[model samples]
Target: MLVISSSCKLCCMSKSLTAWLSIGLLVALTNNAVSQTSHPNIVLIYADDLGYGDTSCYGATAVATPHIDRIASEGIRFTDGHAPAATCTPSRYAMLTGQYAWRQQGTGIAKGDASAIIQPGRVTLASMLHDAGYKTGVVGKWHLGLGPAEGADWNGKIAPGPLEIGFDYCFLIPATGDRVPCVYVENHHVVDLDPDDPIHVSFKTKVGNEPTGAENPDLLKMHPSHGHDRTIVNGISRIGYMTGGHRARWVDEEMADRITSKAVAYIEENKDDPFFLFFSLHDIHVPRVPHPRFVGTTAMGPRGDAIAQTDWCTGEILAALDRLNLTDNTIVLFTSDNGPVVDDGYQDEAAEKLGDHQPAGPLRGGKYSSFEGGTRVPFVLRWPAKVKANQTSDALVCQIDLLHSFATLTGQTLAAEAGPDSHNLMAALLGEDSQGRDHLVQQARTLSLRQGDWKYLEPGRGPAINKNTNTEVGVAPQAQLYNLRADLGEQKNLADQHPQRVDKMKATLGRVRSESSSR
Candidate 1:
């Protein structure tokens, strides 16, 4: 009821408006800070033994990889991407450790019962991401070995494994499909294992009363062409011997479905928080047994059918991201451990059914070789929030650089001793830079060097071609050089013509080998 002046009322109204504007400004600033600081979820889909031309996006007309193609179409398809080595174990080791496998002894292809290759307390990609407040998980092939030097206790807890190395959770295939103790290791224990049955495995000698493929040829549904003829499990011959864990043994055909389901579930579980999933797929490798539904999906036999199954697994992961509305803020990377091999061990009609299909495309070698086709694989990166769609990159990118690249992405500073060989190629990885590593070393039976468009293969003593798999080994008594720009197939040897360049490259390789750290 007290009368007030018009000027006083106006002043009161102005002050109230200023208070609301200040609150609004503070909220807007807080939201901006969160948007800038929030990290993206990362999903690395690693394909085992998948070649440059295995996917439809990479020019594989024989087999259609629609899901893989969708990733490439939606993001960047790299034409000059590579694994660290031509072999599985070394490639995986280098990728995770950020150090070349050759730098350490006993880093070669590990046996089924081998101890953990990656020691505890080492700062790995998973560990680095985990420190940045991300839930890291790994599912499928973990060929880097497990447990201690004495070996893993199949019935008890398996220590110094993925859990110790920074992965919050792990569902491992133990080794490869063609190897044994062919059971899934969930974190510390063997999945579905019966306590009474126990478990025993040996690579040095046969164990248990299980019939071997060598002794029970009549019982095998798939016969080995070479060294994978020891233990027989699920009607297929394996490399190592294993006994017990009968209920824990996985069905080969159902592996894709089982592992894919686990990967999807991990994504769903961690939807509220930033997560990193290493979806390591085991497909198109030896003993290529696709699910019954995908058996006849491809005309290229079991090998092609396995590729189709791999595509389905990729699709499942993409669908999970979509379902959770996490597509935009997730980084999906699709690449292979190494190049392809048609006849690794089992007689799966991979070679016989391969008509005009070129697994490595125009490249010379596959799997175990120093050639372009060996380490160079299909690489695609999709991030709807950052990367533009339908782009192609020829920048020389290698998997070994991912550790440092991701560290940079998460704004984490790596210790000087950590990730010694890993380069910060985040610019190249995000497609912001056109050039990646200036020089890269490719490992096979012999080490090779790639500098710009030139390739140098050091002199080594070995067979030029693998007789068992019929793949070119790329070994020679003298140094070999090639100008990859002019000769993509590596048909012409330019070492004799470019002796100076060869000598320079040789010196560089020598230096890298002698040095403790490349970064």
Candidate 2:
């Protein structure tokens, strides 16, 4: 995740720690002896609310993203990359668990104060990698939530977070950028939270005289269209209440730079050894606040500016790898958590200033929508000398495949219980045969499935168009199916025209969801 580049001192300290950690890990690597499997440094750069066409290489013309585009130009750009789910938390769950997110009930938009989603003792990708002698770390955007089990102390151990799940170290946001308990969570505890000035958060009501966007419109720099209007921070009203932890509170603009710096430092310190870094970026999401230096960087208001900031963060990370001479050995996977949306809560001139900027590229729907735009996102893999450069892959891939792909790459054998839905996409990542899965299931909080060229949306009750943003949710009664190959826009529904195909897809989606649910 991209963070503002303002905190140089903190970055320097992190860099120092990384150097020692790298040495220590290298020593461990040497002592452990090389296993039968050859492991490479893995860095997954996950962007927030990024659409398929947001980057220049992906046909975006609104803002030139030379930095983000460089990944596609340098290595492989996936044409049909997708997030397992349309939202952040579910997509992340799929990535780590290698399973379809929809199978897990209520794996939709999680609240900021929601309890830990991933159960403790569940073998995750991080834990597997750690067991295989790779140092794992997650920086930024831990929307998966944090807790110390039921009725545990906040001042004590916060179990079932990143560290508990398998990451050796973690520096993450307690929830989302728009959510409350708006503080940095480094490993177990909230960063710099003074016991004297304890933090109290609430989404339902406010405890103090915290001015809300609903009541104090004059104090808000960006107005919320729906939800995301509560306690004010840095001139913007967020989604929940935050009473204390003033010193640890992060600046929205500098978020990108800070995350990038931490990611780079982690890489630099672990350059000589195998390490896994999940660099979750917070940009182009709600409350799009670009750094002052990048305020007017694009014509698309804060959204475009935030996209530019994301690109800049990408450039910094790539530069770090090049500087450390690990570009050739390190495998970098860059993709977004979900699709894009112009107006998600905040009124940042995103929709108004969006002059022909197709955030979803050629696809329909975005973000919360069940359309292709909600899950389809730009995915690029870069590994100099190891992966063929400037290549395009039409491999049908999903974030859920990462666990198995990484496991195969590292030659780690996981029990059947772990990553049951994950399939190895190692060949696809290496730019080998382009053909991916024959049939794939997709989600949008709602359970949807896509097989080859056909897309299916299960019968459900949901808004066809989000009234606040006007993005299609791809929901309909009597089961909707579309031939995506013929109509990328999904303007034509073929449920009546192609009943046989619809039945087949329905069966496929049902079987997949049911099997996973049973597991």
Candidate 3:
């Protein structure tokens, strides 16, 4: 109508199209960035007393841990992985706080009535993740202790525990299954506790009128081989004494099912949000009492049967993730607290029925030993979205580094004083790097250092062998050295041959001890 030319009309139309296309491209790029930066759900499955050779994937022919193997086949299996210590309490402590347990006094094997080891104000793995906008929950063994300096009230609220330390929620086995107060504590109170009955526990002296294992041997379904002979609950005697709270006490056979159910429920409830789950399993530990359905499933008696039970629990969790379509964005890690111990306390035919079954595989010593088997444990990590499948890594990874690694993953800054011993091995964990921690410290009754393939053990004063458990404690009157590449079992002592190396390692150990932080 205004006598405009055809070329002018075409130019205006082309410009309009280009402007619309630019807006569409901008919106698409923004969406892609948001998806990339979104945090993934983390699930850490911690197995108690599971050794490097305990699973079929790790070469245990007697036991087939299909569920554990599935994780291995799906992600990365670390051969040189280790726990923080050879003992339970120390290992758990280091993993959570990112500091070596040896730095703190009273971090020894906790009694059933021991006070809280981790204080409220201190930084913890859960606290760090929680601050990073993730809902954290720990469901299973929490042997780190509870209550205040005076100890927890078994009948009332147990304060200054997992909740105080930054966990949004907790369902815990206050101590080891073999210890007293053999009940589950959910959040702050003892689950299913009866107010009228009351509860009392003691490690020093006999408490209550409960019949002891030493006195009532005939009443026990499984007798103690050594020290676990105090309070009898559910026909099994445990370390320390406990009275009342019968309703809250957990049954030995039904424990696997009970705890697994709770863990699964937590995952389901928190599926909508970015969550961190610490699913600590109580399997293949002492007093290995598998359910009736799993009793005769293996030839290694209760121990092998318990391994099978552990696999089932793993399957349950995996199935839940699959059902909820959360598998792709979740990172799952499976590992143990320490090495294997065959007759820890109860008489469970773990030794006698053993036929060609090697718990620690080719590694020497176990549990409380200072040898390779003591600290070296099975570690598998799986992240379907970001990690490649069927990978095996020999990176020198330790549980202590989890705090710093996770902190890096969430893009949070840690205080200078926090995670003193923890290193950021995130690249190694994700299989992006092969070398992890040039040198690592392994703790048992004494301390040892691992630099590359060489190992150094400082001379310490203790029995060379644990007489009761029939295990090598790795104590001696002289310094010890070994090249793990040539001698995996630590059969050859090359200390005399390599005097200079021993001196260097000894000096390094001393330096580490003197320093306030190793990070």
Worst 10-residue stretch by lDDT in candidate 3?
Answer: 30-39
- Give the count of colliding residue pairs in each prediction: 0, 15, 0
lDDT of 2: 0.82
Candidate 3 segments whose C-alpha is farther than 4 A from its true place: 1-38
Q: Estimate each model's TM-score.
A: 0.96, 0.90, 0.96
lDDT of 1 by residue, 306-347 (tens): 999999999999999999999987999999999989999888
Return the lDDT, model 3, position 132. Answer: 90
Q: What does candidate 2's lDDT look like per residue over 291-314, in tens digits?
A: 899989889889998998889888
Q: What is the lDDT of candidate 1?
A: 0.92
| lDDT scores of the candidates, listed in order | 0.92, 0.82, 0.92
Ranking by TM-score: 1, 3, 2
Off by over 4 Å in 2: 1-37, 149-156, 517-519
lDDT rank order: 1, 3, 2
Per-residue alpha-carbon lDDT of candidate 3 for residues 135-238, written as tens digits (9 for 90 to 100):
99999988999998999988888998989988999999998999999999999999999998788999999988999998899889999999999999999999
